[model samples]
Target: MSDTYAGAPAKPGTVSARISPVGGLDVLSRNEVARLRGASGSGLHALLRRCALAVLTSGNISDDPRAILEQYPDFDIQVLQQDRGMKIELSNAPAQAFVDGQIIRGINELLVAVVRDIVYVSTQLEQVGFDLDASAALTQSVFEILRNARILKPQVDPNLVVCWGGHSISRQEYDYTKLVGYQLGLRGLDICTGCGPGAMKGPMKGATISHAKQRRRHNRYIGITEPGIIAAESPNPIVNHLVIMPDIEKRLEAFVRLGHGIIVFPGGVGTAEEILYLLGILLHPDNAGTPFPLIFTGPRQSAAYFEQIDRFLRLSLGDEVARHYQIIVDDPETVARTMIKGLEKVRHNRLDTKDAFFFNWALQIPLEFQLPFRPTHEAMRALQIHHERPRHELAADLRRAFSGIVAGNVKEEGVQAIEQHGPFVIDGDADIMRALDKLLQAFVEQHRMKLPGGTAYEPCYRVLNA
Candidate 1:
């Protein structure tokens, strides 16, 4: 593999270069190379290109998924099969990803991860015919994806904490996330997140300092994302281990299975979707005894954010739902200490139940939560957000509702759908709809729906009180 950079004359903000695989992936079968090189609509090339571009432009602030593509319209990547290994050829790539002509090592690694995951999911999982419909089968598929990425480790303690929050947030909220992460790192905890900017980057950034101070080695900064959301929320530079699940369902499932605990910072619809997904799973009768540490935390200014979230969860899922998590305000140290204790409980529960330390095998995730939810206009309107249903069931639908709003707000497909067919109409119980409207309005008022510098956020859905 030649380290010498060779490419055409650089464009204003883009470069064309051929870079060898750096990490996570190197060799691919002849069949895999063909599929990757296939540019037809049905082939994996489009998906690879989008994800790779996102990785190359890591730490970008924009949430508009299409914005990046429009910025680098000619950017393309091709996988060249070689006898020794695989070579990645880039055309019109983001200039920021390269340093002194050569691609940045971390960006190269993440690019490889994009290719690795896209190929693995398309060829190994889909072509080989995994039964993704069944709940257990879907769970197994998620495990296979993670295992293939080499994220799951054996004989490790339960120390992975998944942090969820919006990419668009205030500097104050971002700083708070960093403090919480620093405290977690001081306690020897690793960080996992959706792998975007703002809150996702903050904790990982904070932990790096604390980990260095503590002389910690082999610390993992894992970033788990899926194809649809990757362009909107590129993986931050702090992420050393990046895994791209096929879709959002598997992405969320991977988080629950891999992380021992979860910390939610102030966020909008995306974060609410995550909270609802976890709460729905935890509320399942079978998972009642399982110990999963979940905390809602933010700075003092963001307390009202958590309060609104708490109220929404209680009103929609029931007051008992509050027991699943605790609220910590402006106190990063206490949050970390609480997480440490919660992790101890998780460790003991794993041992007592004879479960794997790296993966939560005992938790029961129903088929509803495991299935991928496409947020088309018709599908979004059909969601049943009534209170009379079982709490967990209602939580599942509520999660779907938020998931739709997230898609509409950022995901390329969802945004197009909303453009074509106005806002999604969410019809549910009168009280729940009112509460949902108020919460969503707060998110908009707080500039949580989209990054502050971008265009003003338009309502993607209408709440219909029934």
Candidate 2:
């Protein structure tokens, strides 16, 4: 969240610009703008611009942060107040966001989401007056933010399936994910994801067609992202609802809490982080009986990827961890049918336990999994990745290890950190470190670390096998 103004070019399109407010957001106070301007320099402002720009340019393919910034270098967004409502003032903004001099409706909606989330997180989430420390309070705050964003439908059924996977993936694997999504949609399930390309986009694209066929009027394609990763993988065109959490931890938590079940497609470090996070929660003894469906799936070509992931999980988290998820390959219909059966079981469990169907109220997420990880070099080096610890705690550390790699690979702060400090060093138990290193190397070989067109991704972290 650092602001880089020195030597950075100003918005290219113009010295000044004006735009009207539409849809959900329409107001901002002078006090808010002054605070925004004041806080913009302290690092948050640069983050705002990067995320705002990503939202404005929805289908941006380039994964490089500098390239995206350079493309819309002249774009600057300002908050303006009015008697009737509030309007955003864009100075030399991206011409793509405008159609015949008027903002495109979808882009405007996403822009409002950017402003709404940024302001809420900055003012409410970070405020000393708010009780952000208590775990229940933090969870409640997530609920409030989603409610304010109008994402949580109180009357909706337990059918929102959160799909977790990599942004960069193989073409056939992506098509398989789409087929699975189509089957799920035919069965009346909604889709949610990290909301980028590859596996994330596949399901939504597939479901859109089935949803149309089934006349499912309220098909939800929800996208949950954070500022750190949004620039690299901008919201895919299929995203109808986008909510940016304050960080990746909260975003992952939102997925588990809001979704009825989870589907894991082939992914790299980020996907591994997500898997470990979920398994850690479900592995907790208290949550042993909870019925939350988790599926690890891919096309036939992706079988090796899941096999490696499975072996790593069995070796590190214990074979007991296998109780948590099922792997289905080359069968989209079976994947959906398996998920549907799991959802039915989940519904019964919710009814029996008196928990809400829309959110997993009974899942116990420890503070270890809930807290934000800064993933500094020292932190990466200090992680205890081993077999002796409780499985859940090990999962937490493993999740953090992947989280650090994720930062190094994409996040702006991470890139800057890597630039300043060379490469991050990840040290761990010899066996676990070897497996982790091997999996990551495979990701690099398969081009899963970054988008296809960028310069070859240089290794950002070193593995130290102890």
Candidate 3:
């Protein structure tokens, strides 16, 4: 690894440096290092470069997948094996990730996490003792990934609250998320999110201050993400512990499995997708008695957002689905206090069920929620979004529909697919389609579909008449 720096023409914000691992990643097998150093065209190297660049350009706020690449077209990262250990060499990296020529410690740690998870998912987890087909095996794989990341604590109680919302949110909604987070932190709770800007970053930011004021130490601010979305929604600076799941399904699974409770704020299709996924799991007959806490909260102005979400869920799933969660508006302290009570029930439930506190081992995640969903044109069109099926099944398909919209809106492959093949066509039951169309239209009207200043929002999928 060379110490020589590489900078773009007239751009002093680029840097070059060689950095070693801090903690999470220390040694890699020869095969793994070779794979990481493979040619740019190779799948491994391309993924490594993209994820590494995402870490270097932390705090970047664009949702377009190609934004970072265009900004730092000459940037490059290489994994080098030394006699003692492993190191990463960066050229033309973002200057913001450095201080006086040394890479920031937190950024370096997250960079190591990027390399660690990507390598483990690609090389390991499949050789033996792992099966993606069986639901149990797939759940174990999720557990193993979090365990490998050292996120699953053996002694900790149920305090990690998973916060879900959009990266493109309004100022008031964002501030409300922070206030809720601050309240949670003052009560000695931790936070986890998607690791992006806006609502994702706000809670963690607020919690940091509250954690400090309360003299909390070693507080967990974990951020779980996947590779396809990381480039567009780069990890926020507040994410001290980061884990990149293999795909969206696994990422969603990780969230439910690890956190004690979930708090949702006003968001677009992506947030709606999360709500539907969890509700689908809860709707399963096997999970009827489970005591998982789920909350939808935001400022007074954002109450309409949750109302629209509640209407869509009821119209698509059922009124019975309302039993799974509660809605609290314009009250951060109550949100936090309510979560604390919910966490108590979760704690008692886990204890009575003989489950681990660090992970929700008893929740029955159906195979449908565990399977990977690729958002291709045919896959999108083939989704069974009718209400005739079981509620969970319908929720699963509905979740897929929103997931595809999310991919088209931000993910690189989905964007390219839209460019080449045109917008995806989604047709379903007449009533459900009408409800979905109305909800999606509201998202566009509220400016939740994309970042406010980006190009005029375009419908990525045409909701055909059912």
For each candidate in turn, the TM-score is: 0.98, 0.94, 0.97
Prediction 3 global C-alpha lDDT: 0.90
Q: Name the regions of candidate 2 deviating beyond 4 angstroms.
A: 1-17, 39-44
Over 4 Å off, model 3 = 1-12, 39-42
Q: Candidate 1: which pairs clash?
A: none
lDDT value for candidate 1? Answer: 0.91
Task: Report lDDT (Cα) of residue 347, candidate 3.
Answer: 90
Comparison by TM-score, 1 against 2, better one: 1
Mind giving the per-residue lDDT tens digits that candidate 2 earns over 83-108?
A: 86776776656767666566777777
Error of 3 at 80 (Å): 1.0
Determine which window of 10 residues in candidate 3 has minimal summed lDDT: 1-10
Model 1 residue 222 lDDT score: 98
Cα lDDT for residue 378, candidate 3? 99
Residue-wise C-alpha lDDT for candidate 3, range 142-234, written one tens digit per residue: 998999899998888899999999998999999999999999999999999999998899999999999999999999999999999999899
TM-score of candidate 1 to 2 decimals: 0.98
Cα RMSD, each candidate: 1.4, 4.0, 1.9
* RMSD of candidate 2 to true structure, Å: 4.0
